[model samples]
Target: MDLILIRHPAVNIDAGICYGATDVPLLCDAAESARILGERLLALNVPPVKGGWHTSPLSRCRLLAEAIGHVHVDARLQELNFGSWEKRRWDGLDRALLDTWAADLDHSRAHGGESVAQLALRVSSWIDEISRDGRPVHAITHAGVIRVLTGQLLGVPRANVIQWPLDFGAIVWLRRVRGEWLLVRWNA
Candidate 1:
């Protein structure tokens, strides 16, 4: 089975703001990026919104999904809730908090937000439920969600997952072979 994950395109949020799960609109450039990504998926026989299992619950995810065409909104696939950090500027955050979070992502949480482990549990459960179907599935979600899922699949530390660097609207395909999950392609 193949699980295709794609991050939502750029949002219309402010330049330095953190908009985790804030339901922000996509930027003009994001619309263009989504169109291009959709074209590429079509070329790959995976055309966006093609009546398969392509699913997402994010507003931006839904927009992109509908643009390509067969997507369903699945709450289980929603981005991690940032709580108080939503719609705030990252630049204004306390440096001490930032440093501590950077040092230990497992226990880190934005003020009134979720920890890395909390997100991992959610993403892991969503992946498990989908994996049980044993069919190909495409998911349009947030970068943080993707990072957690990729970390789980690859057995990498959560803190280092950001080092993988997922570009806006990029695709990462994970396939399970003989009961072992492996990275088939990343940032496609």
Candidate 2:
């Protein structure tokens, strides 16, 4: 099975603010980003999947998915919820809370939302459903979701996966062939 994963366009929020799971707007025109991405895919010889785009319910992803093609919005594809930290500035948040989260990054729900393990479970469930059909899948989602999915497929250390520099609007193409997961077209 093949999967084409694309991160949504840049958001309008400031760098210091924590805004996951808070539906945010894109910084640029979704259609424009779609146009450019479509061109890039063509250059990479990645043909469009007939089933259309499966996207996170957040507008950041949904809008771009609509711009590119038909969209199937799925809540499971959403970014990890930050709960009370939705729109708060990271620096202003309680230091204790921050430390608590850092202390156990994978298990802590210090912010009252999903832990890394929870995110992995939901994402894996979603992907497993797709893989069952043995069809090429195309999706637009958040970096957090991408990180989880890539880490699960590639057998990378979770800490290192957390450090992957997936730029906004970047495309990641992966495929599972002959019982092996292959990373292809990551920098696209």
Candidate 3:
């Protein structure tokens, strides 16, 4: 089965900030972004593929999901909960805190936020759910979620989940062949 992982459209979070999972609204260019995404999905030409759909609870993701036609608002697929750090500009954060968190991402929590392990649990759960369906599924989510999902599939050794690069609106395809996972292709 083919699984298409689409990152949410570009968001004008003022200075292109790292909003994480704070439920920010999408930018005005959302429609254009969605159109481009739709075109790309059509280009994939997967067998048994239907219209595009799937997204997190965030507006940016949800709007894009609907733009492509059908959508499913799955909370388990939501971006990592940044907790107290939500909406705070990265520049305003304390360097020491960021560094400490970076060193121990699996154990660190941003104020009321969840640890890396906690986020992984949710991601893992989502993966398990999707793997069971055994169909061509399209998912639109945050960059961090993409990284974590890819890292887990690749069996990477990073705990921070930032090792894989996932830009806004990027698309990555993963598939399972004979019970083995494979990275099909990725778009920048």
**Model 2 error, position 146 (Å):** 0.1
Give the candidate number with the greatest TM-score: 2
**lDDT tens digits, residues 42-90, model 3?**
6776444455466788888888877767777887778877777778877
Question: Residue-wise lDDT of candidate 1 within 103-152, one digit each (tens)?
Answer: 77777784668777888887888888777867787888888888888989
Assess candidate 1 and give its TM-score to the true structure: 0.87
Q: Model 3 — TM-score against the truth? A: 0.89
Candidate 2: where is the Cα deviation over 4 Å?
none
Q: In model 2, how large is the Cα lDDT of residue 17?
A: 90
> Among all windows of ten consecutive residues in candidate 2, which has the lowest summed lDDT?
43-52
Global local distance difference test of model 1: 0.76
| Weakest ten-residue segment in model 3 by summed lDDT | 45-54
In model 1, pairs of residues that clash are 49-69, 49-70, 50-70
Error at 162, model 2, angstroms = 0.8
Query: Quick one: best lDDT, which candidate?
Result: 2
Return the TM-score for each candidate structure: 0.87, 0.96, 0.89
lDDT of 3: 0.76
